[model samples]
Target: MMKKYTIENNYIKLVTIDYGAAIHQLITKDKNGNDVNVVISFEDLESYKHNPTYLGASVGRFAGRINKDGYTINGKHYSVYTKNDVHLHGGKEGFSFKTWKMESISEGENPSIKFSYSSNDMEEGYPGNLQVSVTYTIVENQLSIVFDATTDQDTIVNLTNHNYYNLSGEGSILDHELLINAESILTKDSDAIPTGKYTSVANTYFDFREKREIGSTYEFKGIDDTYVLKENNPLATIYSKKTGIEMVVTSNQPGVVIYTPETMDENKISNKPLGKYPSICFETEKFSDGPNQKDFPSTLLKKGDIYKNETYLTFNIK
Candidate 1:
């Protein structure tokens, strides 16, 4: 059995497991003071092992795809695993599939847990002996996830948490309202790889400069795009009418990848039988294919440099 841990405060409760350092549950109070499990989760570790949708796990060594199935580091070409002709979310064996060491667990004003992992040089077709640590902390009504990493050799890295959230806790998120603080999104090819260009969200379905229902426009089947963040401010906000729960997302990352799955059935998440648009993923990280796109912010980490990122998800009642 996989070891699990829990940390709580007056307003929130969080449970996490060592396997993939995945979040098992995040409990928060609703408008009527009822506990709501705002994050999509599984019943067991086995279910997480077979997870294809990356439900609630920390994803890395690169959070998004590396276009053309490979990338170059310091004048050397490196080929990585690809699906549908592009590298997707690290590779076949990503951090989301590995067990991380529980460095520490504590409860106090800031209840928190830290998980650490080391990636060997050339593992998953990437260079550098990279060491990464993810710390999840809860204080008051906020859950903060901090990712820190250092590599022994120059390499590319982008990390983000893959958390599917449904503020209502028990239904589809199609009716939820969303507000993103971005003015543009990375242009993409037919395969969902960034095309080294971007388009303004103004006058487009991509626009979310103001609050709007996720289902307001049916122009696209579902969102799976990265919005270039305008600043290091609160990047997005989500609220649910059924539960009267609100979420404010703040991150220092340059891009936020928003994905609302077209469908969520039993097969997609193992034994978990879920309906269509069950939840939405708000992945804060560097742009997709950032290493290959000269025009985008670089995700390169040097031998001695530290890569640090922080994202905060604060909960409240609308």
Candidate 2:
């Protein structure tokens, strides 16, 4: 059965549902004291059930793409489900399609909710029985997401929330200012798989070291690149002059995928006719295709070991 949960603090409100452990809505106040939903969402549970765009879902067993042939661990190769020659977002029916169990909920100064799921052995061509949990917490103007998991056997894992943001609460994100604390990004092949190469962002269209309008770059094809994050505390920052809202992202992960799709299914969006470049997703997680790239950080999680990734999003008017 599908269930919804809501938790909020003085400065922000968060609503989530057990279906996919997805975020339904996140609301913050603008400079004019108006409520603004920075992320896109659907109108009903049916739309979420067929969430083709991923929307505000928590994605996993692996968050990014994997080569179609799959990866080898402990000298044994494991094949995964794929489409169009790419194993994406943890196969066809990944965590985003599952109904997670609500483990707990707390309401106080810092309200929070915890959801858990158990993946059976070999489900979706993955090895081992994995146990996972995602916790969402709100304190003041900040929201924190914590992902924890453990597997019975050695396996790969990369989890992240797929929340498309439009700080203005409507229209495209072309005018939003973005800044990424990274010097290089992973180069990809035609199939969107990392090519084991790091390209410098200096003087390039991918450069976001300085806060600048997303559309300032001419002929912007849209960003679907993974940035190798520096040791900076906040990995990225986004601001919208239209609403005077700023979002600061900080994560313990080593990489982040900034995705700005050229278009979306407007019919699925609630009370809005969103068009091209409507929102941007900051997927804070390990490098894409890390399992296939020898130089990239490993996504291997051994038995008896715990895998943890924590990311914080702080919002304010500036």
Which candidate tops TM-score? 2
Q: For each of the candidates, give the backbone clash count.
A: 0, 0
**CA deviation > 4 Å runs, candidate 2:** 271-275
List model 1 lDDT by residue over 1-318, tens digit each: 678899999888999988888888999999999988888877656788887788788898999888765888888999998888888888988999999999999998889999999999998988999999999999899999999999999998999999988887856777888899999999999888999988898988678788888778756467899999996578999999988999999998999999988766544342244556788999999988888888889999999999998999999888
The model with the greatest lDDT is 2
lDDT of 2 by residue, 1-318 (tens): 688899998799999999889998999999999999889888786678898678889898999999989899989999998899899998999999999999999999999999999999888878889999999999889999999999999989999999999998878898999999999999899999999998999988788899899889756779999999985479999999999999999999999999998888776676376756999998999987888788888899999999999999999899
**TM-score per candidate, chains pooled:** 0.95, 0.97
RMSD (CA, angstroms), candidate 2: 1.1
Overall lDDT per candidate, in order of appearance: 0.87, 0.90
